[model samples]
Target: MSSNTILSLVTPTISSPGVGSGLDVNGIITKLMAIESIPMRNLQKQQSGLQNEISALGQLTSSLSTFQTAMQGLTTAQLQA
Candidate 1:
């Protein structure tokens, strides 16, 4: 990229205070609560997904054990033959 493009990208714009300039402590607290809830919601989703993965892994392990038992039976039959 060019130098002018980099300068424009790095420059910060100045602006006047927003509409909530005189916002009270209660308003800030409400906003912070909303922000904090977002992470809690995301954590819940991640935990649910992890639970599903664990359940699937448990099923896979059971299936593998069953397959191994079948293989052992087959080997024994071959040895008898």
Candidate 2:
């Protein structure tokens, strides 16, 4: 068999007679599209996680502000007594 024939058998991108060389351009494109979408899906998950963390931080900040105000009130009352 010619080297071209062997290469076609080994690689899917080449065309061969009788046996298909597995070179399906459309299938390859579809696989690549699937691979590209994976990262985008991961980023969406990450963004959701980040939003949750931001919400938690906001709650913590509000709690800290309330605590500080309470402390200031106590200090002022002590000073007046």
Best by lDDT: 1
What would the TM-score be for candidate 1 when compared with the true structure?
0.53
Q: Mind giving the per-residue lDDT tens digits that candidate 2 earns over 1-81?
A: 999999879986754543565577777779999999999999999999999999999999999999988887786669788
1-81: candidate 1 lDDT, tens digit per residue: 999999989999766454557747677779999998998999999999999999999999999999989887786669788
Local distance difference test values of all predictions, in order = 0.88, 0.87
RMSD per model, one decimal: 13.8, 7.9
Sequence-dependent TM-score of model 2: 0.53
Error of 2 at 39 (Å): 0.4
Once model 1 is optimally superposed onto the true structure by TM-score, how far is the C-alpha of residue 32 displaced, in angstroms? 4.8
lDDT of 1 at 14: 68
